[model samples]
Target chain A: MNATLVFARKEALEIVRTWRIWVLPAIILFFAITAPVLARFTPEIVGAVAGDQLGGISLPPGTYLDAYGQWIKNLSQITLFALIIIYGGIISTETSSGTAILVLTKPMSRGAFVAVKAIIHSVFLAVLTVIGTLATWGLTAAVFGHAPADPVWSSALIWLLLGVFYIALMTFFSVLIPSAVGAAGAGMGAFVLLTIGALWKPLSDHSPAGLAGQAAALAAGKPVPDLLWPVLVSLATAAVLVAAASLLFRQKEL
Target chain B: MSAAIRAAGLTKSYGRKLVLDSLDLDVEEGSIFGFLGPNGAGKTTTLRLTTGLARPTKGSIQVLGHDARAAGNAVRSAIGYLPDVPAFYEWMTAPEFLSFAGGLFGMSGSALHDRTSMLLDLAGLTDVQTKIGGYSRGMKQRLGIAQALINAPRLLLLDEPTSALDPMGRKGVLDMIASLRGRTTVFFSTHILSDVERVCDTVAILDRGRMVAQAPIDELKARYGKEKVVVEVTENADELAKEFGERPWATAIARGALGSIEITVTDLGAAQHDIPAIVAARDSGLARLEAGEIGLEEVFVELVGGGR
Candidate 1:
């Protein structure tokens, strides 16, 4: 317990001292705030430039739903990339710089090191996700004067699970790959493969990648397509990956 | 007497290459035992095995009375290890790093705080408040020592602590090791003979994964050292060399240029009394004669064959 706390505190302080931690939150918050505003004004922007050329072409009315959809799209694509690029090197840097030797030499168990890093990252991701969601919510309500028609509870559940799955999966990848570039490459590659898999009609229900993509669908009042098995399989796979990392670390020479 | 560290028939190999081959070692409590070996002589491997960082392929190791294989945690808790290259989180300050290390040993709150402060002072890193990334090599090495001693371990393993430092830095680390002479049993591995001479009372010389010699410094010197007399003769060098070589007290004799001869003798007193008579009978005029004690470096070279 003490070891876990120590490692967590150290990791937390490391994130706080560096720029990577703030970069993700800043980028996510920027996207969250601007996403809704842009969605609300996109038609105006389109009309302003083309309005003088075309005699009259009135566009369809935009609502808070459109703004929320924009926000989700921004998060799923650009914001996830920002999160990956920022947090990808967390464990890889330690391993490459030989800092892991110092920590492992202590009385701390190998499992505790991986677990503490996972917990700290999970907390950071959760806090950032909440902040982004709240910012989008406030802007969408103010701009459109009404909340988007969706099951708020289900949307929150999906977003929270998606954030957790990404953090866990990234942590596992960071441990499996020795170099920062290798880790980031593996994570990004896996993400791309999963995203492509989700696009296939037959695999959408079983694809772990659907967790993040389905958030906007849940927010748009679409029924969830029974994703419990995928979530279960993903969480189980994350557990196994984390365990494999710990086992590899135990036998590692340095 | 309880041994602080003991390894019997310890063997370890990476793939087809054998690093430690059935080597045995016993370190007593409160003794600074120097582990001397050339590069890639398995010094780090032996230290890692004893500290529970790496397991041996064959044989047994007991540290602080715990079996290293079955009781790795217990063994680890009782020992502090410093790698050849000490690395720390660049994001952490000195105090933060020490506290984290203390917490790993189950210390917390005021107790951890007090120890961290004391260790920082002891390591001479009291004023450094910036992150470890800005620290000089010497500061990092000092902090390495501080962290290694955080738990007040029964045995401390240092793998070439001063190998990477400048002369001044090396002196500082050596001084710190010297200060802990009786507080903790230090088992440091290095090819630097002067360092061993500076602080170590017992030494074990390893060569090619085997123990060449292990004993008290004085005992090793006395056992393997050959006493010799240097004599410069005016004439009849060949006859003098033959006379000295044939003497009962002489172990070996080597003839030199300018009618000089170096004679190795088992009984110095007997040879001292009989040398003049032999030279007089051979009618060789002695110009100069000198006698001195043998040095450890010579004995080490003789035993280990001066490789590296």
Candidate 2:
């Protein structure tokens, strides 16, 4: 437990000092602030761009639901891409660059090393998600007027869980691969396949992507989608990936 | 003394190629043991196995009386290693990195702080201001030593710690290692003979994944060392060389200009008594006579080169 905590601190410090601290939160907050503003002003912006053509189309008022929808969309697309970039080869880089040699030689267990990396990464993601979601709530409420709070918060947490699942898979792939580029290749390939699985309606409700897909519906005050199973599955998958990473790390040469 | 590290029939292979063959070794407690081998001699591989970084393809290794294969944190806790390159987290300061290392070993509070300070002072890194990224190769090597000692391990494994340093840096690091004599059992691998000659009490020379020779420094010197009796006189150098070569005690003899001759003898004492008499009888006006002793370089070259 002590080894895990110590390594966790180092990993967290690396993220902070390497500028991931500033860049990741800044990007998430950018999405949070813009999603609501764009939702409230779509009509005016569209009208300005289309000129007389907008007069013929029916314009609807933007609601908190629309803000929530935009928020989930940005989180799923841009924020997730940024997350992949930040985490693509986190473990593999250490092995390839020979940095892990120093630490792994210590009295600490290899299992603790892998666990600490995943734990600290999730902690950083949690910090960003909480801050970004709160900003989204405050701005969306102010712009679109007070709305039901339950759905908005539920959506953010579910989307964040989906991102966490992706990071776990990336971590597992990093252990299997010997280099950073190889890890990213395996992680992104699997990520794209999971996204494709969600495109099929029959599987969409149970796929890894369902955690992100059902967010907007849940945020719109609709009866909650059947997400309990998918959320459970995502959490389980992340745990299994972490376990496998630990096992493989123990036998790894470096 | 009990062996700090012991290996028997240890072997390792990378894919289809064997890197370390079946070998046996013993490193005594509290000895500055040098592992000498040329490049591709499996010195690094042997060190890795001893440190539990890699497993052998065959046989076993024991460190501090524990089977390294079954050894988990227990065996690792007893050993500290400095890799040949000694990679570091570039963003961390020396003190910060040491704190992180000590923390991994479960050290905290004043204990960790004091140990880190002592290591920094020992490595002469107390005044270094830059983060690890800005440090030169030599500084990083010093920090490597500091981290290796942070745990105060019973068996310290250093893989070419001074192989990459400049002359002054090498001397500094070597001096630091020499200072640790009798404190911890230091097992370092290097092809540099001067380093082994400087600090090591015992040495094991390896070639082609096999140990060619293992013994105390002085024993190896006395065993393979050529005890040459050089005699100088005013005349009859060639005739004296012939006479010296024919002597049963003389294994080989070389005749130089003037009356000088160098004879590798079977018995230094017997030849010492006979050579003087021979020179005096020849009336060659004997001027100088001295015996030569071997150093680690010759022992290493003879063993390594002959093994090939």
Candidate 3:
């Protein structure tokens, strides 16, 4: 346990000192603040651009829900890609550069090293998710007033859980693939496959990918629909993936 | 005395290629044992197996009396390993890297801080507070040595620590290893014979995954070295060589261009007695006679084959 904590702290420090700490968070924060504001006024901007094309095309009632919806859409597409770009090299860099040999030769076990990396990345991802979500919430409320669409606390919890699950999954992929490009490709491929599975009526309730989709719906005053099974399954799947990563890492020659 | 590291018939293979073939090694406590080998001779593989970084295919290894295969964690904690190319988190400064290494050994708070500072000074990086990425190859190698000693390990495994260093860097590392003579048992692998002679008291030469010879440095030199006599002659060098060769006491004789004859004899005393009579009989005038002990390099070449 002591060695695990030591490795965890070192991993955290490495992430904090990396250039990504400045660039990744800055880009995410900019999107978080500007995404909702853009959503709130995109119709007007579009109408202005359509001047003389339609003479005038006034948009319908644009509620805070619309702004939240835009926020989720932007995050689901761009923010997730940014996350991959930042975290893709987390394990591959160490392995390729031979740095893992030095660390593994220390008193720490391979299992502890893998576990600590997962925990540190998960915590960083959760914190960034909170920052992004809260910034969007503040901006949306300022532009279109707070609405009683859905329970804010539960909705925020869902987003946080989804972020943790994705981070864990990405970390697991990083361990399974030997190269950074391969790991990133595998992670994105898995994400696409899960997204497709979520569209199927029979599989949607059990697919972890539905967690993010359901949270977006909840923010738009739509029925959350029973997602307990998906939540449980997602948590179980994340655990299994992380355990597999640990086992694979343990056998790696370093 | 307990052996710091012991391996019996250690074997490892990658696919069908046998990297380490049934190798055995024993490093006693507080001895600087040099593992010398040519490239692709399995020196690094042997170090990896003994340090618990890689499992052997068909042999058992024990470090500090802990089973390396079964109790790897325990054995690893007692060993400090420096890879051929020591790598670090590029963003971390020397102090931070050492502290992190100490923490992995379960040191905390003030203890970690003290060890970190001490190691930083020991590694001669006390004034350089820059990140490791900016360090030169020599600095990285020095830091590697410091990190390996962070846990006060019972056994230190260094894989070609000076292989990539400049002259000054190699000298610095040699001095540092010499300074740790009695403090820790060091098992370093290198192809540099001079470095081994400089700091190592005991050495084992490996060739093609097999140990050709292993012993104390002086003992090996004394056992394998041959004594030779060089006699400078003023007259009849060819005739003197023929007469010396004809003698039963002279094992071998060679005539030099400068009217000199070199002779190898099993009994130096008998040859010394017979040489004067042969010189008188052959009417050869001797100018200078010299006899000296053979050097370690000659012994090494004779034992391991000089081509490498």
**RMSD for each of the candidates:** 4.5, 3.6, 4.0
lDDT of each: 0.79, 0.86, 0.79
The candidate with the higher DockQ, 1 or 2, is: 2
lDDT (10s digit) by residue, model 3, range B1-308? 78888889888899998888888888899999999988898998887777667788898888888877665567778878899899998999999888888887888888878888888887789999799999998899999988998998878899999987889878988998898899889999998899999999999988888888889998987787666677777688777887777877676776656767888766677777777777777776768777766555656667677565
What does the lDDT read for residue B261 in candidate 3?
85
Candidate structures ordered by DockQ, highest first:
2, 3, 1
Give the C-alpha miss distance for residue B6 in model 3, angstroms.
1.9
- Predicted model with the maximum TM-score: 2
Of 1 and 2, the candidate ranking higher by lDDT = 2
Off by over 4 Å in 3: A54-56, A147-153, B228-292, B306-308
For candidate 3, the per-residue lDDT at A222 reads 81
Q: What tens digits encode model 2's per-residue C-alpha lDDT throughout B185-206? A: 9999998999999999999998
TM-score of each: 0.85, 0.90, 0.88
Cand. 2 Cα-lDDT: 0.86
lDDT of 1 by residue, A177-248 (tens): 777677777778877988888887556666467776677787676777786876786677667766776777
Clashing pairs for predicted structure model 2, backbone only: none
